[model samples]
Target chain A: MIKVRKLVKRFGLKTVLRGMDFSVESGEFVALIGPNGAGKTTFLRILASLARPSMGLVSVAGYQLPRQAADVRRRLGVVSHQPLLYVDLTAAENMTFYGRMYNLPNLNDRIDEVIELVGLTNRRNDLVRTYSRGMQQRLAIGRAVLHNPDVILFDEPYTGLDQDASAMLDEVLRTVAARGRTVVMTSHDLARTEDLATRFDVLSRGKIAASATHKDFGSGNLLSFYKGVLEEGRQN
Target chain B: MKKIIEDRSPLSLRERAEGEGKTPSGNYLRAIGAVAWKDLAAELRSKELLSAMLVFALLVIFIFNFALELDVKTRDSVTSGVLWVTFVFAGTLGLNRSMAIEKDRGCLDGLLLAPVDRSAIYFGKAISNLAFMLIVEIIVLPVYSLLYNTNLFQPGLLLIILLGSIGYTAVGTLLSAMSVQTRTRDVMLPILLFPIILPVVIAAIRASGAYLQNMPFDQILPWLNLLIVYDVIFIAVAFMVFDYVVEE
Candidate 1:
């Protein structure tokens, strides 16, 4: 569902993603783990068609990025640290607004369904500003999946959530993955990713240092595997 | 949790079945309307942007009243200029706040991620910004007229106001989008916008002044032409270059 080759992203004097190559197949839940400044967010932004790669061949859902960005966007949903919601608007309104952007049919019903999925159905009429951080993040998830997008990208969605909120988000992620949508998420939460991601890739120094399917760990954990990759990367 | 995501493949499948029949232009218009409507509805509920703009406009008018001391004779000459200046300044406040809201709230990124043409987002924002400015201008005109005892209800003057505002917002919207991404966003809009929109401002002042004075149509025609040209050119330029401005 996503493919990139020799991706190079530079912001003036700093190069973030240097010759990075990555891919994801349809329905794969990929937890893209990386150290700080490993360009995980940058890569995701490029996939989301929000940023143009300084140089690379990138495609999402078979549409070339930046060039066919509009088509690509139609199939992609993104949730980042920010909720990307109107604080003044209610949860239902936010969903309706995004649904209309996708030109979704039966928008009201879709909005209701997604709001319920995020467990915000009861609070659907409440203004986003009045909601808790967890509520807002859940609404963001609702907004992202409102269009039934073919792929969804999450960037550090658990940044400020409390334990309960994190558990709720875990359920939301599981629900989304179960729907057979290709999901790529970036997180520092290794324990959660270990359970959720079907595959994990450790990104370091603007490149994917190590990648393994969940089964490859063989009773081991992502923490040990990730540390090993980082140590190996440092040695090299 | 088994039914959390739903089995709406029927709707999506039907949409796909009929997708080929759907025109891109229709989708584009829908996207623009969606964005504009979202902003308008949010503003209506919160009233933050409009209230700030209205209060600021009235304050400026009050300041102008004391500063300019518009006695009857001088009123004709300066009323039009003062009104336009008020609108320009107030419009900048609204524009900066509008885009800044989008940027700060991450709404801009959400809009960009939509499947619509990037220009649709630009037009949507520009239209909403223009609407807010017009609402402020409309209210200000009546207050200014009642205070100064000047008839601001002239058709020609209204036309000039409309044209001038269209041009101002077309450029202002684009510039504000650029400015809000900068470190000095609040101050950056006027600096980036004023120089580019000077032609519209000058033409608006002149044409509005002439209309207020009931000058001959021929005398006001050139300024009107300038306003129209500036509006058409910048709107086109803004529409074309908006994608680049919003690009991350």
Candidate 2:
């Protein structure tokens, strides 16, 4: 489980994650939804141990970070706005490289599996530079899961993807959740995330103003619920 | 290429490993080796970075040939000095391109996402940068020898190459990482890198020059010692500062 208590992060005078608290049990799929500049990325960066929290106790996978981040990074897989694949290498070579980075056994076989899983098997031999944005996005997904990380973080992975690509991504997320891996994704598209995430945490003004499970979300009305949350924040 | 934005995910390693029964630290070296191997293999196929560096080194040498117009009698003493100048400039080209490839293709993010020590990434990149510099030096050596009609094969000169390249890339890797993120990107690499790496390059060239002149061990020893010290200091600084460069 990942536990974050009293988390606070600041940039100069601007506070990003302000006295935030959150936790995720194993296999939970939590979508962190917020507007731009809402500190969603800051919260996630802190959780990923990429940035240090100004004040907080974050215990992830039994590693105390930023103290034991090396340990934490090994089990954590993250896909941010960047596709993060080497353009000079083919998709196969890229995945193979990442697989080796994680020291996964049967690296070649594992690379093949991720390539197929992301449906990039045909393009596997092509240099990633030749890939369309959608193709590169798929390969990015493949790279993230090459090691079968227990915690998967996706920061707006759906941006720039077309409908077909979005559907493919939806399937990928479902497949990952089906494997019981913990997922924390931040997205602006609440409706698209509705069927994918098990829970939604609304980040507003540097804190989680509200949170809900899919069960409590009610009647498949994600837009209304999301709008309501935003309106509630505005009123106060 | 778009810059890599920070992604934060809340997941703990122990929980991930509890199911897989693998320790995170156990895989660190494998991660570094994998990154290094990937770069080496890619370079072997394309030969782009190495070739560019080699050509650039030769161009600088030829430029030096006309620019200096030194008598053949004085060539031996200046051989190491001239070669290092070529190497440092060529080294920056390789480093910039090396890092620019990662930024453009989004490979740096992929590497960062992998469950490996960030230091592994630093070392992997430094080693690859060093390798490219070495390969260029190796190819350039014979050509340099042929052109200058000077014996460039002294074992001491080879050692100098090793140490100089290490010091060069130690700081080169870190600075390149930062430069690649800026709007100016590839162009900014040398601008930022050269100032910081000045000490290393100076010490390297001095030591390399002394070694080539067949100076007594005592005369060459101080510069050699300086090279070693600079290499160690930069390596540590690079390792510590890499996190900041890569941070989203």
Candidate 3:
């Protein structure tokens, strides 16, 4: 559902993503984990069409990046650490606004369904600012998935969530993944990522340093695999 | 070309989303309306944007009233300049906050991620910014009249305010988007906006002064034409380049 080849993203003299090539099949949940300043967020931003690639080609759902961005955007749902929601608007109002932006049909019913999916049905009418951080993050999930996008990218989604909130977000993320949408999430929380992602790709020094599926890890844990990859990148 | 495409039996929104039917181009107007509606609704509930603008605007005029201490003829001569200054400053506040609301929580990215044309988002924002400026201007007018003890309700003056506001917000909306990304955003907007908007401000003040002084039609005609030309040119330029301004 997504492909990137030799993707190099540079800000002035500094290059963040250096010739990184990556891909994900439809319905695959890939977790791109990296330490800070590893170009993980930069890579995801390019994928989300929020930033242009300094070099390389990106195609999502068969439409190319930057050139075919509007078409690509129609299929993309992005959620960063920031909620990307108006705190003053109610959850339902926020949903309705995005629904109109996407020109959704049967928007009211879909809004209800998505609100229920994120467990915000009761608080749907409350202003987003009135909600707890968890509730707001949960509603952010609702906003991202509102239009039934084919590809959803989450960047450090669990940044500030407490334990209970993280658990709730895990449930929401699972429900979204179970719906057979392609998912690419970037984070440094190894334990949570190991629990949720079907495949793990380690990003270090602007490239995919290592990658393996959950089954391929066999009896080993992601922490050890992640450590080995960082050491490997350092040595090379 | 778009009118013909919009007339066809296009796919329903659901189908277009579910399949690879691309953007629902027919919803162009609808997208712009949705954004404007969203801005107005948020502003209505919060009142943060309007209240600040009104306070600053009223403050500007009151400060001018006290500082100038002009006689009736002097007041008549400076009225247009003072009014435009109040508007330019107040409009700056509105434009900055309007885009900041979008950027503060990453809502700008959310807007850009929509399936519609980027220009739709620009126009949507410009329309709402214009509305907010006009709302402040409307209130400022009467207050200026009350303070200055002068009649300020000429139809020609109102028209001049509308046209000047349209030009200001059109260019302001685009510049605010650019400046919002910088670290010194609050300082950046006026620096980028004021010089470019000189033509609009000058033409507006001249035309409005003519109206207030009851100058002859031939005398006001040139300033009026200048205002019209400036409005059309800037609005068109802003429309054509908004995609780049808002893009990363």
Best by DockQ: 1
What is the TM-score of model 2 when looking only at chain B?
0.88
Q: DockQ for all models, in order?
A: 0.63, 0.33, 0.45
TM-score of each: 0.97, 0.87, 0.95
> Candidate 2 — which residues are off by over 4 angstroms?
A214-217, B1-26, B45-48, B181-192, B237-245
lDDT of 2 by residue, A1-236 (tens): 79988888888898888888888998899999988898998887777777788998998878887888766777788887678877678999888777677666656866777788888888899988799888888888887777667788999999899888889888888877877778999998777788888888888888888898867768587777877899999999
Error of 3 at A163 (Å): 1.7
Kindly list the per-residue Cα lDDT of model 1 for residues A1-236, writing each as its tens digit: 89999999999999999899999999899999988889999889999988999998999889998899988887888999899999988898888788877887767767777887888878889999999888899889888877777888999999999999999989888888888889999999988988888999888988888889968885557888888899988888
Docking class of 2: acceptable
Name the regions of candidate 3 deviating beyond 4 angstroms: B1-25
Candidate 3: docking tier: acceptable
By DockQ, the candidates rank as 1, 3, 2
**Model 2 C-alpha lDDT per residue in residues B4-81, reported as the tens digit of each score:** 111224432233433565665556666778878888988887788998988889999988887877776588668877
For each prediction in turn, the share of the native Cα contacts (below 8 Å between chains A and B) that it retains comes to 0.66, 0.47, 0.62
Clashing pairs for predicted structure model 1, backbone only: none
Comparing candidate 2 with candidate 3, which one achieves the higher TM-score?
3
| Model 1 regions more than 4 Å off | B1-14, B17-20
Q: Write the per-residue lDDT of candidate 1 for residues B1-50, one digit (tens) a residue.
A: 44445443765622562375667888889888888899899999989999
